[model samples]
Target: MRELLRSAVAAGACALLAGALAPATAFADPTVTIEGYSTDVRAEAVSALVAERGLGTASAEALLRTQEAATSALDAALAQLGDSAAGGYLDESGAPVVNVVNESAATSVEGVTTRLVTRTTAELESARDELEALPQVSHTAIAVDPVTNQVVVTVGEAVIGAAGTAGLLAAAERMGDTVRIEHVAGGFEPAIYGGEAITGGGSRCSAGFNVNSGGQDYIVDAGHCTAAVSQWNVGPSVDASFPGDDYGLIRNDTGSAPGAVSLYDGSVQEIASASDAHVGQSICKSGSTTGLTCGTVEATNVTVNYPQGAVHELVQTSASAGSGDSGGALFAGSVGLGITSGMGEDSSFFQPLTEALGAYGVRLN
Candidate 1:
């Protein structure tokens, strides 16, 4: 089965700690408190999957197993790709699928299934470069969907009618079906809110996770949000990376940032540690507007072109979240998942917590 470390209840959901892998925050400020994601939130998502994706409980459990088994090996899988293996993911059928360039690489692994693809990842990367060069390509995101063995380009409907869009479409056409274009109704934007109510800048953003860097307590969030304001509900902005990356670190001067995520239902989940997300893994998002929503990771290493600029290395999931959710917590049970970055009705994306931690030299509180 897929494995990180061990397994345990995340918040109250059936989900496991990203690894089975919390603490009480010293709250001197009454406004600063930890909220947990509700157990019902996961129930809702699972129900939707049953109704919409023909998903069953058995399928869900199987997917979780495959996810645990493959996660640790995924990095090695990529490293050892023999010009054939494009990538891998778990399918709705609860089958672990991997893309291979040749038959020799198609052998079944412990928890994996395989498929053959004609194009190599390098070739898809070249197509992506071509698409990125187009001027009308704003409001779009692209990633390699290993399940489909193709480069999927998601665009906002607003750009569908733009004159420059034609060039993008032409590039996709030239790719001979290797490039798939999908349209989203609302264009993607950073969901930063007026931070004032949350003890942040006028722009609002959800607190990602409480972290400690070099013995300093801080709250992690979207750089775009942090770039706009210097103070958070509990403290001041100390370190951040934006434009280049999308995380901001706020120093806790008065109180400690909690090692938990709000459930919005008056509970909090302990964050054991930070971890990277994988395609097909079930994930939950905690945002101010939408609260907590869960879905499976549909894509990884996604690059989003928001109105503000481009943000890369995002994890794309089927979970739906919106406005004022920027820098919100994205987690799996007890494992620290991600920080909310952007979203659409059908999909949402996050900046992985592992990267955020590494970039800021921090660890989960």
Candidate 2:
């Protein structure tokens, strides 16, 4: 009786194995999916049998049910292939892995996306902090014309109300204490405007530039410089504008001489037509306060408001600016960015080169 029962069991197992190996007429394609997205190709069913067996019985049983269903479907597809030798099964420990040739591979997207977002956020925050630490000012000033299209930042006691001077001080205080500030006493040389010594106890003033309006010349300088100058020393040939209009010209030079525009330390660039500026150009500057500095044009036609008033329509650049650096020049290497008008930390502002030309009528070299 026992032998008969054993023989019957063997026959049943053999019949089931034969059914699984039987060839079918239609060979259905396997679907590959990653992150819920489907791919058009064949795929093999792989079961992950963890040796640790840390999962509870209920979870393990659920996993087993899923594995069996996937395996049965894969087997059905394989049987229809017609060629039994093309694919086979792989055994890793007790886990049965079905290997299907020419299967489409899917990428692990969730892990990659998480990493990219984390890195981008970190980089943006770092850049913002760096920008906020740069030098900036709260002062305002008028633009005077010494040569053509130049701005001046008064220093010393006159710097109290001087537009360019006040703006410079505000920017400087933002920087670290490593930088030192000083003033050039006893006037050096007058270039565009007329003055013996600017920033003195008497009618104090600093250098500036001239914008050629038609045939006339209009002086531009740091608006703050005018507050320091109690009386106008401009010439018989020059007219004046202030506060709302930061542009003016040399109308007189009685005992004093007309100021010129300084280029480098002691060098100067001849003013031609002030309309020779374009986007993406380079520029250099020289100032009684900051001396000479160079940078590139960042933008044009920028308007900025200050405590004194608002100066509209100016140029901007990445040029480094500090106290006394206001009313300088923004140049394209040899070209010009206009004149140093205002600054924010490391960034500096300039009057429009075209505006200067339109206001005065002089050419920029």
Query: What's the number of clashes in each of the models?
Result: 28, 65
Which regions in candidate 1 have their CA more than 4 angstroms from the true location?
1-45, 58-62, 73-76, 93-95, 108-110, 160-163, 194-200
Residue 158 deviation, candidate 1, in Å? 1.7
Instruction: Please write out the lDDT profile of model 2 over residues 9-121, one tens digit for every residue.
Output: 22111000111111111112333232211111001011112222343433433343343333344344435432321222212221223222232211221111011111122
TM-score of each predicted structure versus truth: 0.82, 0.38
Q: Candidate 2 regions off by >4 Å?
A: 1-206, 210-219, 227-245, 252-260, 276-279, 333-337, 360-365
lDDT of each: 0.67, 0.35
lDDT of 2: 0.35
Error of model 1, residue 258, in angstroms: 3.8
Global CA lDDT of candidate 1, please?
Answer: 0.67
Tens digit per residue, CA lDDT, model 1, 67-136: 5446656645655665667877766654556678887777634346667788877887788777777773
Least well predicted 10-residue stretch by lDDT in candidate 2: 11-20
